[model samples]
Target chain A: MKILDIYARLKRDMNYIEKELEKSIYSDYTIMRETSAHLLKAGGKRIRPVFVLLAGQFGNYQLDQIKHVAVPMELIHMASLVHDDVIDDADTRRGQLTVKSKWDNRIAMYTGDYIFAKALGVVTQLPNPWIHQIMSKAIMEMSIGEMEQIRFFFHTGQTIRNYLLRIKRKTALLIAISCQLGAIAANAPKSVSQKLFLFGYNVGMAFQIRDDVLDLCGTEQQIGKPPGSDIKQGNITLPMLLALQEESLREPLLQEIARIQAVDGQTDVSAFIRMIRGSNGIVKAEAMAARYIEKAIVALKDLPDLQAKKDLIRIAHFVGNRSY
Target chain B: MKILDIYARLKRDMNYIEKELEKSIYSDYTIMRETSAHLLKAGGKRIRPVFVLLAGQFGNYQLDQIKHVAVPMELIHMASLVHDDVIDDADTRRGQLTVKSKWDNRIAMYTGDYIFAKALGVVTQLPNPWIHQIMSKAIMEMSIGEMEQIRFFFHTGQTIRNYLLRIKRKTALLIAISCQLGAIAANAPKSVSQKLFLFGYNVGMAFQIRDDVLDLCGTEQQIGKPPGSDIKQGNITLPMLLALQEESLREPLLQEIARIQAVDGQTDVSAFIRMIRGSNGIVKAEAMAARYIEKAIVALKDLPDLQAKKDLIRIAHFVGNRSY
Candidate 1:
């Protein structure tokens, strides 16, 4: 099935999740309500919630039970994004002004905290202690991954293994747990939830790798922000790291990165973007992402063959191949 | 019991709590480890944990069970302080360089997130979902209170009711839950825990009021920061608001505040500090705090007259009358 087809299939349930998201972040404080509502309206693909809903299909498929997992997953994702914007000094996200830009960094910080707390509040309404454990661990890992990103900024000496670990913590773990928790919430067998976790984890890896590659290659309209924002913000992603390994591109790219760092990322990065695009980095990164997608599909092989399984496989492929 | 005697009574368990706090914040990353450890070392009174441990005595009083509540209370407090430093642009807290100052705002933000996640992880080990629910709600209220603080900064029109509400969320809620959760963790009677919550809530109110008054009237050595730091940062405390009501001081105080705002708080605030100190604001704020302490004592009137009850009352008095 196509990505749009899956979203359409889940449209009614997704609407519930969306409204629940809005309700979860509602605050009596005017500025908080405005800032959080601002973030809620600046929509994304809602892929995490989608993954949760699909994974729940493998179980008894109860929307009420699964939304407890789904909404918090999306809320956590939203909270991290707000905090990330503050760290990235980003003004725009998903083609809208960020909380930090629209209000201020302090507002963004507390808004993120408030949303995260709301997410916890929603999830804790579930009676399972295991779900709480997994969610909190994912949050801790994500935070460590965020700090690692800051530490690795402008440092080209980082290995591909470091990049993988960072992205695994920063993105993949939450996705993995979304599937795992969704299945568990709906009373899926432990074996099925474990397999779904592996599937989500591999897909999340591909998803992030594709995102990094798109940062270098996608247009302004396609990516929703300026291309090369990663490099401009000194984030050395997998593609950039892979590109640095090219002997012919290494010296010139290093010099360009050095220049950007010297000016504290004030310079235009179109030249740097062009150089990476012209290199083998794009193809190599795509190949790695395809490998992760393959593993994701393989993880689902042991599960009962259902339409949701096929949809998961299709979503994995879409994540691997999507240009935007 | 004297405060030192209370510490002596709980020394062994408090040591375990201290170690658990260290273990809770442990990270594989060097920077995460160092920043968190630094915060742990630059300790405050650990008053929240003390309340938790003391409140646990009214129940079955298992140190193992109560430490979970105690440690997380302190960790959440630590996490908020780290984030507050980022928002306040504060360099020193408790006579040590703030994480934001020593590293950067990005590091401080993630460090706070990491610590908060760890707190949740520790708390979820307990089987009771109610604890998680209460904890998460307190976190949400605290974040709202933090945002309200920013919203009310330098706004002289804010009433005493607004200030009370802000501090209730920011300070009292967590302390109240610390007592409530501690009792619940130890399997205390519902009525007992409810009363403990009320006791903690009032003491926390008085505790914050005393801290605010000391911020203006105390020396740098006494408060661990500068005397006029609150006014300098545009934090309009109760004493300041009360002082603003004075006919003799209103015009000059407003002018000084305006001048500080004009320069973005870069100028000397000693003149502002002296004016508020010499006014009747301190005496009136003290009276209000004393009322809270009285309420706190009244909360414990029906609890069995154990030594723990006396300790709780003495702690309430200490909070109300603390000079530093």
Candidate 2:
């Protein structure tokens, strides 16, 4: 099933979350208000909140009860995006000017911090200490993951182990928590919450692998920027790691990579993308991602067969297949 | 009593906090660990923790119970300072190379974020939902204050009211929370905590006013950095605002301010400093600071006649009179 079809199942709750997400980011500060509105306008798939609501459905499924958790989870993601743009030094995200590009780095940093504080402020509205603990740990891991990315930037010695650990911290953990927090907040059974966490974790892993793969294969129109923008930013992704392991593709790719690393100007990254795509790296990465998707599907089998379960299964499939 | 003498009263608790503060910043990531260590070695006065401890003393005064809350308060301060250095584009702080100078802005930003996350992670050990709420609001206000500072930078149209509001949010709010959180964490009565918050709020106002004053009158040795460092970074402080109001000093100072705003390089700020000091601006600012100290003393009157109250009074006096 398509992602939209999956989203269609929870349209009411999703729309409410979308509204709450917009309202939550409104600040009295003019720049903050404008920047946050700019981000909200440049919308995402609202996948995290969708996962949150879907997971909550397994329990009491009260929109009012789960929204405080869901909205802030997405806001946390939004805040990270603002900071990430500054780190990537990117000019556009989803065909819109990033906060850092439109303003300055200082403003971007403040905006990110402001949004993060807003997330914390909103989440604290709920009286659950465990939710705070979980969210705090996820945020901490994400920051550390960002730092690790910075440390490993343009470094050619990155192992697949390093890439996996970084992706888990930077990307997967937040998604997993979104599911776990939703379930726990709605008073889902511990067994159900644990399974949702596992399912979300596996889906998160696959989701990131698919994202990395698309960075190599997708077009600028499809991905909202150049296909190899990650490569341009010197982010060593899964396909790149796999490509480097191949003897035939390795040296020529390394030469191009070295040239790109050495210069300040935009080196043509399309050539590097082509070289990686030509290898078995793409196939191997896809197979790995598919395995993760399989694990996610397997984790869902033990849950009570609710309509939300079928939607979640479809969502997991869609994460593996999404182009953008 | 002098500030050091007040500090001497809590030397044992202060020492323990100092060590915990050090231990808390340590991370598995090498860059995070080293950068955090660099910040720790910069050696703040550790005044936030002292206030926290002193306030906690009014309650049950268990060193073990309050240490977690106290340590994170200082960590939040340290994290803001790191980010503030980037905002200020400052190379040196307290005669040492700032994190941005030692590494780069991206590293500095990440380090600040890492420290903030660590603060949250550390504080999550406490079960109090109210502490989380208080700390979250303090952090949110601090970010808004930073954005306001950014918004008002180099704009000479800023009023004393704006300056007061900014300083209260950016500086005083966290200090107030440090005291309030300490009392609350130790299970102090609501009345005692409210009074302590008021006391901290006034003292913090006085503390920041004194800091702004010292930025003008203190020697380089006393202030660590040069006087007018704030002006150099386009920060319009209380003394500068007062100096700008003087008819005799206005035109020349405006001309110099215009020149500084126009050029990117170092403009000689000594002339503006001299002009402000030569006027009654310093005197007026000091009087204002003194008024805040008086207010802080008044807030303490309702509290019990305890050693902590006396120490807090002395601390307020020291803030009003401090050279740096």
- Among the numbered candidates, top DockQ falls to 1
True contacts kept of each: 0.85, 0.61
| Candidate with the greatest TM-score versus the true structure | 1
- What are the chain A TM-scores for all the models, listed individually? 0.98, 0.97
Question: Which portions of model 2 show Cα errors greater than 4 Å?
Answer: none
Every model's TM-score on chain B: 0.98, 0.97
Q: How does each model score on lDDT?
A: 0.91, 0.86
What tier of docking accuracy does candidate 1 attain? Answer: high
Q: TM-score of candidate 1's chain B against its reference?
A: 0.98
TM-score of each: 0.99, 0.96
Error of 2 at A315 (Å): 1.0
